[model samples]
Target chain A: MVRVHNLFLSSDGYGAGEGQSLERPFGHANPVELGAWAFGAASWPNRTDGAGTRGLEDYLVRDFHRNVGAEIMGRNKFSPCRGPWEDHPEWEGWWGEDTPFHTPVFVMTHYERPALTLTDTTFHFVSGTPEQVLERALEAADGKDVRLGGGPETIRQFLDAGLVDTLHAAVSPIELGGGSRLWTSPEELDDRYHHDVVPRPDGVVHHLFWRR
Target chain B: MVRVHNLFLSSDGYGAGEGQSLERPFGHANPVELGAWAFGAASWPNRTDGAGTRGLEDYLVRDFHRNVGAEIMGRNKFSPCRGPWEDHPEWEGWWGEDTPFHTPVFVMTHYERPALTLTDTTFHFVSGTPEQVLERALEAADGKDVRLGGGPETIRQFLDAGLVDTLHAAVSPIELGGGSRLWTSPEELDDRYHHDVVPRPDGVVHHLFWRR
Candidate 1:
């Protein structure tokens, strides 16, 4: 299945905030507030305390990389660099040498670049429509599901093309006045998916959708 | 306390749909879809079945008319008629002869009209600002809490003035592409109010806000 997991959104439908920079990938959005749920999960990969909350959030946190073999993301999500790859030869993405993904990562960009490997995760900068990108991602994913990572517009394209099979969007209570909006309202995907709106005790509403 | 109860909204933050008219008070919004939670609740006054779901939603349904002694609504909510009183001379509003509201109802209008009565509910047409209207509503309430009946813009006025002490906004899963928006995000009120985004099993996310 082509899936999107743990995509956080604001009540007003903004996925990320405005004024994104290399220093702040999510722009003006307070990463602490946005990632609190994931950070507190017992299964959180980056948890330094050794113990965290074991709630439904923990289950999701554990499921983040369960069977995902490959990841696909928008170009902007890959790096803050907006121009040609030549402009920033030193930029190896926000993730350092040892990246998160254990599988191949496809970065959808208009300006294609040769495959670059940061330890285990190899990034292939490919340019194509949603279908073409998914084909490459699916092939790279092997038998497992391909996780579609987003910066909002990327996921929107996949959703619009009906290429997405399952989507798990967590809406945080905070609202960014302006930003890259994921959907005017999530119901826009109702025609193609069966939706389950589940809310956690911590004021976060999770929208889980599966293709019908 | 000045309260807003069961104020339904789309996921996009729209409280009511666009092009509201005499026939459709909520414009393009489906009343059945919007009120499903309340309609299914055992405490819903209008429920003919007598037996409905006994959940948090039901509790809210029962709480609807609790201590609310008076109601303050925008003129547009009172009547869709944009012109003068003469145009809607015989229009007794969308509510029938026996209006649901048993207490005094205050309708804010630029062009005032004499008070009218329909069974137990007395409709009082008054002109004033948010504070002014709230004061009148509070006075008419006679020590009881006042209900702020809205069409979105009316509630926005009260919110802007910080006149609303409590607000209960139920966000339905549906998305109205465009309409009268309640807030860019529920977080916009976070500065002055403590917000709780609680979601029921039926997919309705209730945003409860109380003045801090």
Candidate 2:
């Protein structure tokens, strides 16, 4: 059984982004807080020796990282281009050298592109339906957990298909007037999901749930 | 101006219960890890006591709490009743003698009920539109800030109205198979929203955005 995870950032009542620049799409909350909940222990800037503190953030970060084997992300997350990022072929990702994802990453896009190899990560671009991308991700993960790194649509597709396993959500304290929403419909959820609330000192709450 | 904040729980893809009861809605992630993020000096829990560790999580939590003057929640969060929580009328909130939201709390529901008063927190039930509820909350906040707690619909109304000020979202590592959809449309956003990304030790990422 493969576990599918979806990660996202939310606003108070608004959407995620303001301007169209990838540099600051979500606003200034705290990268450490966001990454801690998604990447877990792997969030540490230096995997080798960073002299980081060991606490709740570290524990959860490590737990999530330990479970994931491969990742699937939307083309927007993989590049800064708005539509058909192919126009600008040189743009890669916001993360410079030594990107956090040390495993294989699959990017979902409509345009075709070759596989990209960064420091310890390899990004394979797929041009097809989400199911096709998931199949490739599962193959890459090899029975390990697969993560859905989303802009929005990507996670919604997997979620609508009932393919997700566990969900961890960190609710930051800021609110966007509007941009892109994180969730879609509530009626779609039956008895399949559970809920927990973890309040952070930064006013963000960490919520987790899994399949029933 | 009154600021509206939204909060909720999500799961991995499989739709598993967060294993949350009225007692623990946060589920069963490592307590130590959660504590690290929630009880840091930056958060409200530690600012008065200095009980938790100091890190990025703490700082962000502190920033979130500092901006809040009051809170507004849906009837579901105030009580555990799902379809017709008012029918039972026996259930109250999970918070015991001393509830967390020490400030004023306005609950939106169709049923009319008496106000709930804990030590420092007071729960007021409003049976009007979200705008009315927000107006009362803003008055209660007294020129401070107001938070819109969630069931989902309540947050959606506020988002649709473009009444929120700042949004802080924590992207957890897991994905709920199904429960609540965060975003349904992209046109809901205006130019007032700004997003920033905050990475954490765990795979969680916190996105902070505010209305300008």
Candidate 3:
């Protein structure tokens, strides 16, 4: 099953705010604020100080790599550089050095490029519709479930196509007035998915969904 | 202090849906669905069965009338009938026989009419801006706190004017595609108020706000 987990969505349904640039991947949004629950969790994988709280939030952060194999993400998630690869050839990605994924990472892009390996992760730049991309990711996943990495629009494309199997969207309390919205209301998915709102004591609500 | 409590907001930040009329007070939205948490509570005063569940929701329901000496609402809250007083002279509120608001109720309307008293509550059809209406409500509240009763737009008016002191907005998990929105995002009020999101064990999240 294709899955999405630990994704932080702003209260206004934005995966990332407007004005995205090389300096600011989340655009006008402060990623630290939106991912407060995850950043504050003791189980956070990338913690520098190694000091954070534990509970449901910690559990979510720790569970980020449970059973995911190959990961699929949009072009923007791969780099701040937009358009063709010639615009910016140097693409090390936002995740410095050793990236999180230990499997093949499919970067859905219009421009194709030779697969680049960084530490344990391999970045494969490919172009296709949501279906085409998911098929390639699933093939690379071997027997493990393919993870659908997102920035909202990527997930939305799959959602509109009814290709997603399960999803865990963390609705952050912060709001961005204008941005790319995944949904006006989550109820839009009720026809195809069963949603369970898991409210953590820390006030971060996670919307869990599975195809019905 | 002027407070707004137990106000239900859709996942998209709407207070009420479109197509509002006498038959549908909340427009296309279901009032039962919106008030499910409170209505299901054991302490719900309006529970006819005398049997219900307990917890934070129950506490909020029972706390509804506490220290509330008066209520300020939009004309639509008083009745679905719009336009001048000539449209619908029979202005009995949607609350039925004994209204929940025992305190003096100020209904802000452009077309003013004589005050109507129902059982323990008195509905004053007053005209003025949000500030003017609030002033009258505060006066009617005596020494007790005033409650800003809303239908979404009403609360937004007070919010825009910075007249609201405290607010407890219940963010329901359900989503209504469109309606009267209190906010595009809860963060809009962060400039003037400190907001705390209290998540209930039952999956409901309440946003509590107070002037900084």
What does candidate 2 score on TM? 0.45
True contacts kept of 1: 0.06
Q: What does the lDDT read for residue A78 in candidate 2? A: 72
Q: Distance (Å) between predicted and true CA of B144, model 3?
A: 60
* Candidate 1 Cα deviation (angstroms), residue B21: 1.7
Q: What interface-residue Cα RMSD does candidate 2 give after superposition?
A: 11.8
Chain A TM-score from candidate 1: 0.95
> Which stretches in model 1 have alpha-carbon errors above 4 Å?
A1-212
Q: Against the true two-chain complex, what DockQ does each candidate achieve?
A: 0.03, 0.02, 0.01
True contacts kept of each: 0.06, 0.00, 0.00
CAPRI docking class of candidate 1: incorrect
Backbone clash pairs for candidate 1 read none
* 10 residues in a row with least lDDT, candidate 2 chain B: B8-17
lDDT of 1 by residue, B1-212 (tens): 88888888888888778888878888888878987777877668776775655434654666678778999998878887876787778788887886778999999998888899999999999887888878888899999999998878899999998888878888889998888888877889989887766766767788878777
**C-alpha TM-score for every candidate:** 0.51, 0.45, 0.51
Q: Write the per-residue lDDT of candidate 2 for residues A1-212, one digit (tens) a residue.
A: 23433244554422245554556745443444444444433235456654343334543454445557898887766775766565677776777767878889998878777788889899887877777888888888887888776755666677777777656556655544455555633223437765445566657566555555
Candidate 2 lDDT, tens digit per residue, B149-180? 66455666786787876555454555454444
Model 1 / residue B144 / CA error / Å: 0.4
Clashes of 2: 103
